[model samples]
Target: MLKLAVAPVPYHWPRARILSFYADLAKAPCEILYLGETVCAKRRALTPQDWLDLAETLRAAGKEVLLSSLSLIEAASEVSTQRRLCAGSEFLIEANDLGAVTRLRGREFVAGPGINLYNPRFLTRLHALGMRRWIVPIELSRQGLETMQAHCPVDVETEVIGWGRLPLAHSARCFTARVQGLAKDECALSCADHPDGLVLYTQNEQPFLCLNGVQVQSALSHCLIDAVETLQQLGIHSLRLIPQSEGFDAVLRTFDQVRRGATTASSAVEALGRLAPTGLCNGYFHGISGMDWVAPPQVPQGQASLDAPAPRKQ
Candidate 1:
């Protein structure tokens, strides 16, 4: 059966906000939740112990919890913290970088999307290293996934990011700090000001990307509400929805409805379009530009646009 999972928050939210968010999420319908800071280490509103405690609370609420590590490790302190997170928890760790994978050898771990497991051979090697599951890299197309699965020799749970902005890249330098004219080390937790991430625009005033501390993301949220059937056909085990600042509960309900056959994919897509103000894109999944929005097959081509506004409530 295909399961629904929530990814860790990729932005810097205040401690109280984080606590409140998880308190609400504890009752959410998703079967799995990832907890921890995955971006800059300086944005530690919650201590490592706080994340573990939250994970326990969610677990008691019937959700599987995993601790996620930083995608870009730049300091010895960050490495030490990650080491503690991996060693101290009974929960599985989501290894975002190669170092995490090396540290997690002989233990079951999840290969996060940041790790590039492009081909069958690499995946097999990781499986040998005790990778029990992996999220498909956002840059990989559906066809690419299908091809890899057809040739893969091991059995592992496969997951795809079903919603939220695509995390395109991570850097050692903080873009948010640079934008605020502050040194990286002196960044005043500016990322907390934009819980959904600070948007970066193009020369033509087009919304291009989002700068969340060190992580760069697609300005438009990625939606695969229309692709549930396709993903199931390809034997994907889980659909991961990254948490956003707002409307995430509705997003989860929409995906769950579609997965349960209570709603049609078209209707779900239409309803979801109203939730994402910057519109939705499945272009990366369809092997196109990550910013481009492709309409479902039932809808005519060109019906979807990058600048699409959320539909008004009738």
Candidate 2:
């Protein structure tokens, strides 16, 4: 069976809300939980100790807890956090950048989606360095995965960013701070105001992208709820769900049902439309544009269910 894991939160949110959110997640159906500040280092809502404590709590609850490092490391403080996270003997670490991978030498670790592992040679080198698992980068197509999966060592598990807003790019400059007319150094941690990231609209008012401090993501949430069968066929061992502000638990349940063969993919798509912040897309899986959703086999035939309202247009 395909396992479910929740990716670490990408946006900077209040500490109280962060705690409450994870508290709810500890009881959810997710088998694995990737926790830590993987985005801007200045978020400061949780200290390293806070993450360690949360990891222990989740581990006690029978969840496989993995600590993730930042994607864009710009300073000594950020490197220090990475060292501290990797040096720990308690939890497995997910290296989001090459620096983290360098520190994780000789130890089993997870290569996060930020690290570009596109070809067979890349996976082989990482496997030799003790990479026990690798999360497919969001841009890699399904065919791309098929060509690389066979090259991976048998013990190394394969996972994908199965759901959530696609994290497109990261930079040294904080776009969110720039938007607020503040320099990166003097910005007053303003990203907290927009819990789901500030949507960047095109001049004509079409949703184009999102600004999250140093990370720029697609405005449309990248959803693969309709790709369960393809994911299974591709031999993906786990599916990663990036946490969002609303309907997250329901999102997990719907994916869980589809993976278990309890319902059809179209039903899962409809269920996910009700649960996600935006419409679902499986384009990357189908070798199309990342925003396009190619219908899956077994789409439900009846009218949409009344349990949740249709997703609002952005």
Candidate 3:
């Protein structure tokens, strides 16, 4: 059976709100929950002990938890922190960088989407290094996934980003701070102000990108709620749903219903559109532009679809 896993919150939410969000999520239908900050380490809404305690709570609530490492390792202190996380045997660590990958060798670990798992050979190497599961990079198409899975030499869990804004890139310079005219070192934690990230628009006022501290993301949320059967056919073991500021509970319920056969994919797609007010996209799944929404054949007439994209550049 396919399973759902919650990715750690990428935004800098307030401490109280983070607690409330997890408290509500503890009872959600997800089988796995990833805890810890995956972006800028400056946004310390929770300490190491705090994350461990939360992991224990989620585990007690019947959820498997993994601590996620930062995507960018710019400092020795950060490397030490990841090493400490790798040393722990209580919870599995999700390695987002090569440093964590090296430290996590010989122990079961998750390869985050940030890692370049572009080929079967690379995946085989990681598998030899103790990678038990890996999240498909957001930019990889369905066909790409199929090819990689076909050539994969060993068995490993394949997880895809089922929902949330696509984390596109990370930089040493904090884009959010620069936007606020603050230096990266003295940014006053401005990311906490925009929980969903600050949206950037094009000249025509079209949503273009999102700036979240050092990370850049797609303005529209990535969704694959209607592709459950396709995922199963591809032997995907899990759907990793990234945390959002609102309507996530509905997102969970909708995916749960669809996966459990209580509702149709078409119905789930409709519900998902309403949840993501900025609109939903799955074009990356169809080998098209990541920002465009290419509706699946399962969708019926009159359903809300974000299609009619400009012709792809030849």
lDDT of 1 by residue, 192-213 (tens): 8899888887898677788999
Clashes of 3: 0
lDDT per residue as tens, model 3, 1-314: 78999999999998899999999999888899999999988888899999999999989998989999999989888888888888974898888998898887778889998899889889988899888899999888999999988876556889999998899999999999999999999999999989989988889877778899999988788889878988988888999998888889999989998898999987777678777747778889989899888776766666446662232111
- Provide the overall lDDT of each model, using Cα atoms, as 2-decimal numbers: 0.86, 0.83, 0.86
The 10 consecutive residues of candidate 2 with the worst lDDT sum are 301-310
- Which regions of candidate 1 deviate over 4 angstroms? 300-314
Which stretches of candidate 2 lie above 4 Å from their native place? 297-314
Better of 1 and 2 by lDDT: 1
Q: Which residue pairs collide in model 3, if any? A: none
Clashing pairs in model 1? none
